[model samples]
Target: MSFPDEILIAGSGPAGLTTALSLHEAGFKVRVFEAVPEIKPLGVGLNLLPHAVRELDELGLLAPLAAAGVACHELAYFTKRGERIWGEPRGLAAGYQWPQISLYRGALQFTLLNAVKTRIGADRLHLGRQLTGFDATPGHGVRARFLNRATGHEETADGRLLIACDGIHSAARKIFYPTEGPPRWNGAVMWRGVAECDPVLDGHTMIMAGHTRVKFVCYPISSQATRPGAQQLNFIAELRYDTTELSEREDWSRAGNLADFLPQFESFRFPWLDAPAMIRAAPAVWVYPMVDRDPLPRWTHGPVTLLGDAAHAMYPIGSNGASQGILDARVLTGCLRHHRADPEAGLTRYDAIRRPATTQIILSNRQQGPEACMQLVEDRAPNGFQKLDDVVSRAELDAIAAKYKQLAGFAIQELNTRPSLASPTA
Candidate 1:
C-alpha cells in the first residue's frame, strides 16, 4: 500500500496547530480537528521559553507574540520572608538569540489558529469534532473517527498518519492505554489568576516564592493589561493538601473561591510584593490540581503517534510543558520529511527520540526542577535567614538551575548554537 498525501491531527491546541504549520512548511497536507464548538481567548498565562520561541520565530510568529506578551528578562527565586535565593538572566538577556515570552495561553492559541487557517486553509480545520477512536489499517494508513458534539453524529477521516495532540485527557491515548486512568494528582492544588498590579522587582522578572508546602509564583504576562506604569501579573498560589483523594474534577476553567486558599497565604506578605493583596485584587481565579501522567514506554503504534501532553504529561515545573510540545512538532515534521518513503519509520524514530527525552524531564519535574532551590532554603532555614548563601550556597543553587535547563533542552549556550528546526524552504 502507498502512503496517503495528507496527515490527520487531533486537537487544535498549541501542539496540533504547530504540527500543522510545520508540516505545511515541509510540503505536506494536514488537517486539524478540535473538540470545542468555537475557539476563544480563554486561558491563563504561560511562558514560552527561548527554545520554543525560536521555533515560533522560524514560523514567522515572533512579532505577533511579542506584541501580545511581555519578554521575560530574568527569573528569580525567593524565600517566604522575601529573601532572594537565586537569580539569573533569561532569554535574550542571558544571550539566547530569541526572547522568552510570557503571554496568555489563549492568545497564543488563537495566533496559531489564525496562522493555520490562513496557511493550511480554513476548510482543513474542523472544530466541534471530538476524537472518538482510531484504527490502523494493515499495510495501509489509519482511520480516525470523531463525534460532532453539537449533533451527536459520528464521522470518519482517513490519512496516512494520525497525530494526537489532544492534551492530557487524550481520547487517542486512552484508546491505546485502556487501563490507564485520569492524570495522577500529587496532592497539591494551585489557584491561578491574573491581575493588573505594580511590577515586582524589574518589570520583566519572573519570581517564585516559598517552597513545596506553600508556594507563590508571579510573572508579568502582558504589558497591555493596564497603563504604561502597570502590567498584568499572572500568579499561582499552590498548597499541599493532606488528603490524597481527588476531590474536584480536573478542569483548567474551573473557578476557585479565594476563601479556601487565601488563608494559606495570609502571612505571605513581603517587601517586594504582597501575596495576599495580589490574590485579593484579582477579578477571578482558576483552581486545578498539580497533576501529571506516568510516562509510557511507547507513544507510537504503527502509523499513529502522540505529541505534547498526550505523549508525556509532567508537573508544570520549569515552564517546559508547552515548550517541549513545540519541540515535538518540529522534530516530528523533520522525521516525516526525511522518511517519506516509509512514514511508519518516521513515527518510530520520533517515538524513539522524544519518549526517553521527555521521560527524564517528567522525573526531573517531580524533584522540583529549578524550583528545588526554594525547597532547599526552606529545609535549611525555615526561620528565615539574614544571608541567603549561608542557607544555600550559590554553587548548589546554580547547579540546580543549570541542570534543569539542560534537561529541558534550553541550556543558554546550547540553545543559541542549535540548528534551526525549520525546513530549508521555511
Candidate 2:
C-alpha cells in the first residue's frame, strides 16, 4: 500500500486544530477546512480538565493558555437557600501533574488556532470552505467537496484521509446517517452567558447550584477585567422544558429571550451570589436545548472518519465536551503514526481506542456528571445541612467524585502513574 502525502481535516475547532497540529508535527502535511469565513472567539467558557491540559502542555500551549485563562482551584456546591454542602480541590491542589483551566471558549480556540498557523502555516488552513460531501476509495484515498462560505463557490480536494471535525450538525455525519435527525434534546433547555460580576466563592471557584428542576453552574473565567471589582464570570442555567422548539436554531450564537427563562431563576438568591442579578446583567445570552446523540456504532467509513461533536455530542454537564475532542486528536494522531502504511488500520485503531472511551463519557454525562455529586447532597439534606455528616460521609462523597475522575481519565492518581501513548516519530 502506498501512503498519500496530504491529509484533509474538516473543521478547525479544538479537535480539528489539535489533530492538524499533531499530524503536522508527525511529518504529515495537513490542510484544514473551516465553514466560517473567520474563526473568532464565539463561545462562552471551557473547562480544560487536567488530562486535556497535560496534552496541551506537551504541545507547548500551556503558558499562553495560562496567561489568558483562570487557573481554577476549587469547585463547591450549595443549596438555593445558602448552605454549603460539598467542596473539592482541583488542579495541583488535587495532586495532578497539570493544572485545571477555565477560560473563554474563544480564547482557547484562538490560542490553538495561532499555534496551528505558526507551525502548520497559514496556507494550509482554508477558512470559509464548508464541507458539502465526500468520496472515498478503500485503498486509494478520500476526496472531499466543499463550498466557500463567503463566495458560495464550490471546490473539491483530495487527501490520504478525511476527518469530519465539522461539529454537531456535521455534513459528513448526515451523509453517513441521512435519515437521522438533529441532536437528541434531553427535555432540558439551557441559557448560557458570561457576565461581569464581583467575586463569589474563593474569588477563584467553579460552582454548581440548584437541582434537576432548575440549575445554575457559575464559574470565573478571567479576573483581570479593566473595570474595578468586576470579573468575567460564565454561567449556564438549565430548566425542565420540551426541546421540540430548540432544534430550530442553526447557529449557536442565536439570541434567546430572558422573559422565557428568568422566571425559574428569579428568586434564586444565595447569600454568596445572587443568581438572578448575575443573569439579568448579561448583555447577551445564548439559549439552546441541552442535547446529546446516541453513540454511533462506528466513526470510520473507509478513508473517512469523525471527530468532536460529530462523533459524540454529549451534554455539557461534565465539562468534557472540548476535553474529549482534544483526546480524540491525541489518539488519532497516535494511530496514524503507528500505522502509516495502513490508513484503514489507523482509522480502526483510532476508533477502538477513542470510541469506547468517549461513549463512556457521553453516557456518564447523561447519568452521573459532576453535578450528580451535588445531587446526592441535595437528596440527603432536604432541610439543609445542620449536620453534614448525617446526609453522607465525607469519605463516601470523595470516593464518588474520585470514581468519576478515574472514568474520565483525569484522576490525579492516573495522571501521576499512567504511561504515555507512543508519540509519533514520523
Candidate 3:
C-alpha cells in the first residue's frame, strides 16, 4: 500500500525524455522505452518558447541548449504580398527571464536524450521497443507490454505508473481510445524544408509570412549547419486545399514534391528573403497534413497517463507545441513529487492542470492562435498595403499576442514572476 518509487515511460521524444530527467532529479527510478533502435537528428526545426526554456534551465541545460541553436530575437509577421504587418521582440529581448530557443527538432531531442543518458544513466534507455499494450491492476500498479522491434519479441515492463509520449500516432493513445480515429486534418498541407542559406531577416529572427490559408514560416535553427555567413534555416510552406480526401500520405518523414506548394509562394519575395529561391535551393522537403487531435476530457487513467503529442497533438502555431510537452514533463514530475504519498492522485492532479491548458491551445491553433493577425491583414488588404499600422492597429496586435502568451503560460510578466514547476523539495 505504498508508492513503488519507480516509473515506466514510453516514447523517448522530448516529453518522455524530459520526464525521465525531471523524475530522476526528484529522486525516482525511470526507464524510458523508445521505438527507434537509434535516436538521431531526424526532424526539422522547432522553437522552445521562454516558458519551456525556463524548465530546461531548471535542469541546468540552458548552457548546452544555447550552444546547440539560435536564441530567436524577434517574431515578425508579413502579408502574402511581403509587407511587414506586426513585429515584436522575443525571448530575452522581450524581457522574459529565459530566451526562446529555435533549434532543429532533432537537436532538441538529442539535447534531452543526452541529458537523460548522462543523468538517468545510459542503461536505463531501452531502444527499439514499441508499446503494444499495458495492464494496470488495482494495487499492483501497471505492467506494460512492448514489442522489441529489433528482435520481434514481446517484452514486459512494470512500474508504479506509465507515461506515454509516443507522439501523434501513439500506441498508448490507441489502447485508451480505440475509436478516436486519425488526427483531424485541417485540409492544409505543410511542406517543410531546412536549407543552409545566407541569413534571412536577422540571423536570429523567426518570421511568419502570409496568412491563414497560405503561409511560410522560416528561421535559422543553427548557424553551425554550414560555414560562416550562411545559417541553417528551417522553413514550412503551408497551403489549404478544398478537399476531404487525404490523397497524400501523412507521415512526418514523407518526402514532398517542391512543385506542389512552392508555386503558391512564388510571390513571397521580400528585400530580405526570397521564399521561392530558398525553397528551390533546399536539399530535401517533407510534406504532411496540418493536423491535431481533439482534446480528451482526461489524460490520466489510474496509473497510466499521456504526455506530449500523445495527449495533445496540436497544430504548430505560435511556436508552442514542443514547449507544451516540456511544460508537461515538469508539471507531471512536480505533481508526482508533491503527492508522493498518493502518486495516483498526482497523476490526476497533473491531468487536471495540463489537460485544460493544452486543450485551449489546440482549439486556439485551429483558429490560428496569435497568427490570426496575418489573416486579418490579408482579409482587409489582400492587394497589400503601404503603411503597416493602416492595415491593423497596434492595440489589436498587442491584444492578440498578449492573449496567446497568457493562454500559453508564457506571458512575459507572469512567466517571469511565476515560481518554478521544478519543486524545491528535491
Query: How would you encode candidate 3's per-residue C-alpha lDDT over 46-147 as one tens digit per residue?
Result: 999999999999998999998899999999998887788888999999999899999988888888898999888989999999999998975458988999
TM-scores for all predictions: 0.97, 0.95, 0.97
List the candidate numbers ranked by TM-score, top first. Answer: 1, 3, 2
Local accuracy of candidate 1 as per-residue lDDT tens digits, 1-426: 454667999998899999999999889889999999998887789999999999999899999999999999999998888888889999999999999999999989989998998999999999999999988974479989999998999998999999999999999899999999878888899999998999888899999999998999999998875566888999999998887678766999999999989998988898888989999989999998999999998998997999999999899899988889999998898788788888788888888878999999999998898998999999999999887767778889889988888888898889888777654211
Off by over 4 Å in 1: 1-3, 422-426
lDDT tens per residue, model 2, 222-270:
8878689788999888887644455474456878789988888877796
lDDT of each structure? Answer: 0.90, 0.84, 0.90
Score candidate 3 by TM-score against the native: 0.97
Clashing pairs for predicted structure model 1, backbone only: none
Error of 1 at 398 (Å): 1.0
- Residue 306 in candidate 2, Cα distance off native in Å: 0.6
TM-score for candidate 2, residues paired by index: 0.95
Itemize residue pairs with steric clashes in candidate 2.
Answer: none
